[model samples]
Target chain A: MRDKNLNSKLKNNFGAKANDSRIYIFLVIVFVIIAAIYPAFFTSGSIKALVSTSLIYIIVGVGFTYVMIGGNFDLSIGSIINAGAVVTMGEFNRFYKIFGGVEGGDSALIKAWILAFACAIGVGLLIGFVNGFLVAKVKVHSFIVTIGMLTTVAGFVYTYSHGNSISANTYSLVDVIDKSFVKIPYLEVFTPRFVIAIILVVVFEFILLKTKWGYDLFMVGSNKESSFFAGINTVKKVWITFIISGFTAALGGSLFAVSMNAAVPNFGERGIAPLMFVLAATIIGGTAMLGGSGSVVKTAVATIVIQSIFSFLISMGMGFDAQVLAAGVVLGAVVFFESFSVYRQGLKEGERPALVLEAEQLRLKK
Target chain B: MSSDNSASVVTLKSNTGKVSFNTIANRFGVFLMIAVLLVVGAFASPRFFSGANWLNILSAVSILGMVAVGVSFVIYCGKYGDMSVPMVMALSGVISVEFMRYGIVPSFLGAVAVGAVIGLINGIVIGKLKVNAIIWTLAMNFILEGLIRWSYHGTQIYPDMATAVTYKTGFLLPLMAKLDPNIMNIDLTMRAENFNALAQTYFAGGIPLMLVVMVIIMIIGYFIQSKSSYGNKLKVVGSNYDVGNMSGIRATTIVMLAFMISSICASFAGVFITSVNKVGAFYVGAGYDFQAVTAIILGGMSLSGGRGNIIGVAGGVIMLGLITNILNLFGVGTFTQKMISGAIFIVVVAVNANSLRKLGKDDA
Candidate 1:
């Protein structure tokens, strides 16, 4: 009897390990497919591009991973990106032109870059702070509150743009933004935007994994009741997660706009596509969607894989719509497969006959 | 000693009175917002009282109203409301248009059937497999959108030339002919069809069909949500699955039924939308799902599930129409209207939360 109990425990642990390995194997397959398509995809320039895009997603995903892992949802990430892009672009254009040597010269670009960086990061933090306040302090469900924010931000974007694109030429900062930095095997890829994205990811990742506050957040997310019993400030942790989600999304939006050289109302409008992809990857990385376990590294890797698949699909003569469809299918499949175990478990304990039958059938097949 | 114990128990009950009221009110808060908005709009806008504007508003709301009715059921069943409403709508519309060349009946039936199939898939995933409704439904939305895009490739189909002339121009011919005849009148710079009709056609009389259909759907929703055994079972299951299971309620079936209702409503909404637009595309139902969600929220429905009524959702649809109409009267731009709408939505939700909090405190 003792031996049987020990064996069952071992089997359960092994099943979980097997599940984790399945996701990793799937991610590796995606990477392999990309490499098989284009040798150049693995080159320095492509790597830089891939890393840059991944960096944006990774930053945003890190914040959202906190919320999702913590057991909340935010639909406002897309809108936050739009809001972030508008803020960063507005600042870059306004200051860059003022400091442009057309009025003064080379020194003007540097000054504008510094100012743009500050504003972008500041705007992100501000949005994050508001999201945190509303969600944690006011005790509103993040989903409903975020949907409202989505519409508000979308409206703001349209209003701020005056229904037109903000051109890069208007702000002479376009020149400084286009300048790329090469750092041997790995390009530091210095754009005022790229630099900010890297710094935010590194700093935020540290705060999430290495700090007491992050641990508190993890505790609160894992179980509010237990956290409260342990004297953790659960509400504060919830607030912090929302804030971080908003800030990171905003920062990502700004970087994307800076790279594209314009802030259109539609800029980051479809950011949900990338956001969902990041979510799938984060979940696939063994980060519990029910809230508690997540890794910055795993999420970063997933982001890269997603971006590579997108680029590869585009290269294979797929249009924007097809690319989106393919990505969605891939994401759905991954999540479905990843959560299969939990789903199977739910069925076994469930009183529903249909679910029980299905579970039995699945077991038989396996 | 028994009498003394009774007195303390009464005091304890009184102390907890505040919480019950708060909880109940929070559950019905969306309905309150809808009522308040409609009342405010009716009084504030003179044009709102006109028969034609009312008809127009109802016509505009029919699509979203139908979809919201479906989602409310899903919420009541305890699963996250399916987010594939837009895709389902588009699917039905696309299929309808594809088969329109055969006749209206074939097109309509085909679309409805397709919608049913989609709902079945949703049911299977959410009910049987127990996939997270949000992700599963969202994924389904992508697949539908992709299928539509891939099939249509952005090419939109217009009504048959004969149908176009007969159905569309027939209504306008009398007005157009009258305008041409009166062209010589100095005061008739604008045609009667254009100017006189715009001012005079304040009430559309030929819309009983849509109104009747809308009421019928609401009645059905009411029956399913409030009166039916299935409905009561779903509520129990949603409130607490363990309790429901103990009662022998089939949780998966209730969930599946909810998804089916949502899909059917989405399909019906798409049919109405295709009628309104006279064409369908990938973006046909793009924003409709979100609008329906907003209506559900506005109707005092809880996102967490287990509490809502069709009457509330109907009131919500009416409120949404009134808000937009009122804003239009003030010459608000689309962007401004969106901003105001979003602000109002958030405020309503906040108010609901505040009332609930107050109730909680009172109970404590």
Candidate 2:
């Protein structure tokens, strides 16, 4: 009995670990193919650029993974990003007006940066609260609520900015957070956002794997009624996930704005692209769309894989539209493969007997 | 547990009677809102009550109504909504115009055929393969958008003599043209003249041609949804997939049929839109997907499906058109209008949800 228990336990552990490691293996395979096709992909400059751009997606993907795993979608993440970016830029402009011509004064710049970050994060949290309230309390479907919020928030952003891109002359303020660290030869690149993204991934992964809340989230996702019966506040857990998702998307958006030194009202105009990327990353990371299963670390790695594909396509001189098309194809192919594998696994796990019995019963009745 | 069972039974008894009441209230509620809006519009602006303006509103929403009818079918089958509708619309419009050399009948048929093919692919993937509807359709949308863009090299195609000839002999011309001899100028071979005549043409009592087409489609959609065995099976499948399968409903085939019907309707709408605009562009059908969805939901159809009808969807299309008209008359900017519509959509959905709960109806 002891040996049997040990054997089963070992099998379960291996199975759980393999689910995540499979994505990593796929990522490595993709990297190898890309490197072989374009030897320049290994260059430090290319790697740095890819990481810098991918960090934002990774951050958003990590947060969105929580929402997806909790059986909900945050489509408003794109609009939240737009709102965050625009709000941050707008605040910066306000600070600039108030402190007119700071002339390299570090104090004034630091204050401006602090204010911008607060405003961005605050707006994200507020939107998230509303999303959670409606979806949980009002019994509105998350998809409709978030889609409406996407339009409403986007309109607010455009209205606030007068449908214009806000360009700030205060490079000093943005540069504080945008600065790089530890330049390593030809790979010298912006490391602040990359570090932030890495920190978020580690923190989220820890929370998702090691905490009771994480377990509750998965339980609620897999079966809400069961979770309810188990005394878990599934609604509260879902609300928390949306808030985290919103907060991360906002942080990433604001960071992007700071890096670009401008925040256009329509920055998230490629509305579905960021969403598609987040979903693709999450799913590619072995996250089930049906909810209840996913990993933050796997999602981060998946983001890298997707980003690498885009970077490769860019190097091949593909335009934005072509890149989008390629991403769609990749997303479709990944989901298709994942669904097929899951189906096959089900078939292998004694589902065939039940299915055959059902079929035979139908035949007999006919 | 015994009390819970008793309560559920009581609710079930009350629900049977309330179902008809709820349906009537839901359908009537939209018209009531429209009436309220019409009254407000009349008071707000004199032009709102004009026959010409009413016709404008009807004609403007004709394409949307057709698309909503298609979307309603998918929703009826419990497939939330087709994200590929917009792309299908654009592609079909482009195809119809592109194939004008093959004559009008063939071009129209070709456009619908293309739509059916795309729908078949979506149906097979989503139904047979059991893929998530939203993601698969969304991916299909991207692929279609890319294909259309690449094919046209991101340029718009204007209707030419061939298109004009096709329109002239097309069945829609007589149905669309006004009864007045002076207004129904069908002989105009010039593209602009032909388009203007078609645009200005209305049936007796000033009913637009597209409106007539919309009504015909709605009737057909209603028949397929309510009268046909396929429709009955679809309702069963939508309400409970496991139950449907147990009952030998062939849930996958019904879902595919729903998608195909939706695509066909959207294709017809595409042809109508291109006819109205006199141009076929990749962006021609942009934003229609969301608009149709909003309309479908507003028309009393739940996103969870298995409820609502084509008539309700028509009311939704009309409601949307009326809202736009009212907003435009008030000199609201497009952005503000979008914000208002978004808010209204949420409110409608919330109320619908509350009503559904009160009715003790299961979502899926």
Candidate 3:
């Protein structure tokens, strides 16, 4: 009996590992299919561009991964990105105006950058704190709280900006943002943004796998009641995750401004395409939708997959509508298949039915 | 001991009077807010209490009320309500307008049938297969919006030709010709004067037919949720799926029915709203999902489900409409209106959480 139990546990770990690799396998298949149609997709230049475009979202999505892995939703991240973008840009411009010299120099730009960064990040932390306090401390549903935050923040951003785009003084931001300290073997035109994404993935993935805090966070996500009973500070852990989520999303916002040199109102609008993309990417990255587990590296790769899908559809003469539909179709298919596979796995395991186990647990609780 | 506890809960003068206060805040907050808003509105603007403006507020929120009532059922079933309501509304309206060549009533039926079909898809996937309703419906929202944009080439569908009214060849031609219900007592500009009469027609005493229809739907919803066995099954399943399943309730079927009812309501709202605009576009249904969800939550209904009622939901919807009207009278901008509503959403949800915490319960 002990041997059987050990073997099952081993198989479960091995199964999860296999599933993690499955996303990359699927991504490779997608690449191969695209390569068959367009040889240029295999070229280094387009690959670099693909990573460049997905880089910002990878930052936002990595933050989102923290919240999701900790078992929470942050629908307000898109709005956070909006607020961050607007604040950083608006603050940068305001400071730039005050500090501008007849002959522009780096010192003035550096000052603006520092102030802008502080204000932007401060705003994100504030919002994240509010979301965390309400969800963790007050115990409101994260979904409802974040939805309200989405609207209220968007309303404020719109009110402040008057629904117009704010363009910033870019040399200071561009010089720092565009610098590439690390080089890849094959990719010649790699940017620092790509490096930042890789670093975030590696660092966070390590923390999640190796740290006690990470384990507790997952425990909380898996079973909040049990985690609480086990003496985990579930509320604190959950609240901290929201802050990280907001922080990363806000970081992405500043990067967005740096890349575009502008904070456009479009991101905060109802389309919420960025939020949708991150959500789709996170789930596609092999994150368990019911929480308890996710991989930062896989999420990064998933971002690439989505970015490729966007280009693939566009290259095939499909319009923006096709791209939108494809997100829905792909997300829907993944979720449905995940559920189906779970159902099939349940039957295969011949374990007690989930409902029966749940019933038993309820009785125990009572 | 139970009677002593109840007596304390009932009497404000009791030692733990705060319990009574919390009970009222949790249970009757929406109704109280509606009453307060009515008083505040009369004070804010002379037009607020007038018969004509009151009718306008009813008309303005009629579509929203219908959708919210349906969403309340979805929330009651603990599915987080349908996120695809906006898309469903837009798609159904567009379908109705596109199929007008088949005659008016058939077109309406066909449009509503599309909604039912979409709901069926949602039901099967989320209910039978046990998928997450919020994500699935959100995906459906995207797919439906994409389909609309793809089919229409990102253009709004008009009523055949600049809405040029023609002498109807059908049986009701004389009635439509004599009465352009577009001009009937509503303050809204008749943008769709020649579009359709079903949406425009007013009942006796100038009560818009749409308001009447909405009230009837809410009444039916109240009965179904409060009185019907189906509703009891829904509450049982929603509160605890395993318990409901073990007790022999058809949990999947109840869930499917809830989704269908929600979609059907969206379809009804779609037809009415599309006629008002005289054009069908994806953007037309853009904000209804959030608004309806807000209204449902504001109605003192629990998002975790199996609590609150249709009457409270109606009060919630009316209160929203009333606030917007009062804001309009106060000369506040639309963005400010949204901010206030959004802020209200957060406050109300926090209060709701506080109330439920006493039972050692937390809503999703």
Candidate 4:
């Protein structure tokens, strides 16, 4: 019996490790195929651009993974990003005017940049707190609350910017951050944004995998009642996840704003596409939408893979609508296959999914 | 022991009373809200109470009401709501217009056929495959939107001259003339007139045709939902899929039927919308899915499903219409209007969650 137990344990561990590496393997295969189709895709410049553009999604995907793993969703992340961008740009412009339009070498310029970053992050935290409070304390559904916040924050962003793009000639600080450095083979370069995104992915991955809080979060998500009974503060953990989600989204938005050197009122108003990217990245990274398992590093890699696909599509001369359609198809196909696997597993276990089980219990009680 | 029993009985009586009161309030809340809005509108703008304005409200809400009714059907089956409704509406409208040269009946049938095909896809994926309803429908929406946009090459299609000529001198005019000779006089050439004006044509006592159609649909919806065996099966399936299946309810079939009904209603609304706009475009049904959902929730239907009625949904539709009309009268911008509606949606959902909790039916 002891030998049998050990063999099963080893098998389970190997199975998990294989599952974890599946996304990376898939990504590698996709890269190889793309490179075969377009030799330019393998060039360093194309790679650098893809990584740089994917950084924003990677950041947002990491944050969203936390929320999803904690059994909630933050649909308002796109609006948060928009709000962050607008506030950052608007504040910088306001500060520049306050300081007599100083161009460079001024303490006022630094102060303005600092204030803008703080304001952007602060707005994210505030929205996150509201989302957390509603879902945790008020017991409102996260989907509805976040959707409401999505519209409300979008409205505020438009109102603040008055449907205009905020632009300033004195965006030297942002420009510097966008500057590429450390050229790799084939003339590819990394930007500060790419480095920052990598650091965040590593740091968050460590936090989720190597901390007690991470275990608590997963426990709370997978079995809230048991976690609560075990004296874990599930509500607080959920709240913190939302705050992290909001903060990451804001960071992404601010980075985007700085890179572009402008913020438009209708920023992120294209609707659903940004959110879909975040979701697709996280899911492709092996994060289950039903909650309780995910990895930030995997998500970051998944974002790059998705972005590379987008780049390939663009190179093939597909329009924005076509790209969106492709993304949707990919998302649906992934989810369908995942669900089918889970359904097969449930059948093997001789049990229904939790949702059906809960519904059955509720009916029986009546 | 007798005194304790008596006290327990009193508490139980009060509890039952409170439950009934809550049920009543939930059922009539939208109507109460609408009544208040109507009164306030009358006081705020004299024209709000005018016959022309009422006709406008009815015509505007006719399409929305149809969509909301369809969403309510899906909700009744415990599927939350269908995100594909808007796309289905747009697709159906586009298909009908694209097939207009094939004649009116054939084109209309084509639209309905498109709806049926989409519905079948959604129902199979969500029902038999048991995919998440919202996500699956959302993906389906994107696919439909992409197909429509690709086929149209991002261009709008107007009614062809042949169809226009037919409307002018063909069966439509004669049908209208027979329905109301006074309204369809020779002075009004159908070719030069807006097709929507036909929808606005009044019957006896100045009742708009759209209003009559809405009333008929609502009555039929109410009967089918509240008085039919199929509805009973749907409720059972929605209430508990596993239990219903165990009890031989064919839960998958019931769920698919609910989705089919939803798409059928959406197709009908699409035809109406096309008639109203006289043009087919990708954005024709934009925002209707969310709007319909908001209306259904405002009608006190639980998002978890197996609750609410068509009458309540109509009241919700009217309440939304009044709110928008009042906002427009006050010159509120689109952003603010969206914010207000979104806020209201959240509040209603929160309240619904609380009620579900009280019933000990929290999904969590």
Compute DockQ for each candidate against the true complex. 0.29, 0.40, 0.50, 0.36
Please provide, for model 2 over B35-149, each residue's C-alpha lDDT reduced to its tens digit, 9 standing for 90 to 100.
8888989877988888899888988999998999998888887787788898899888877765554356666798899899989988988888788787788778877776665
Please rank every candidate by DockQ, starting with the best: 3, 2, 4, 1
User: What TM-scores do the predictions have?
Assistant: 0.83, 0.87, 0.88, 0.87
Model 4 C-alpha lDDT per residue in residues B286-334, reported as the tens digit of each score: 7788788888888878777777888889888988888888989888887
Clashing pairs in 2: none
Give the range where candidate 2 chain A is weakest over 10 consecutive residues by summed lDDT.
Answer: A1-10
Q: CA shift at A52, candidate 2, in angstroms?
A: 1.3
Once model 1 is optimally superposed onto the true structure by TM-score, how far is the C-alpha of residue B108 displaced, in angstroms? 1.9
DockQ of 4: 0.36
Q: Per-residue alpha-carbon lDDT of model 4 for A221-278, expressed as tens digits?
A: 8888999999999889999999999999988888888888888766534433677788
* Candidate 3 CAPRI level: medium
TM-score of chain A of 1: 0.82
Cα displacement (Å) at residue A220, model 1: 1.7
Off by over 4 Å in 4: A1-17, A103-105, A183-188, A267-272, A351-366, B1-15, B18-21, B160-210, B359-364
Docking quality band of candidate 2, CAPRI definitions: acceptable
- State the displacement of the C-alpha of residue B352, model 3, in Å, after optimal TM-score superposition: 0.6
Model 1 over residues B175-236: C-alpha lDDT tens digits? 43355543222232222122212212233555644456667888999998999998899889
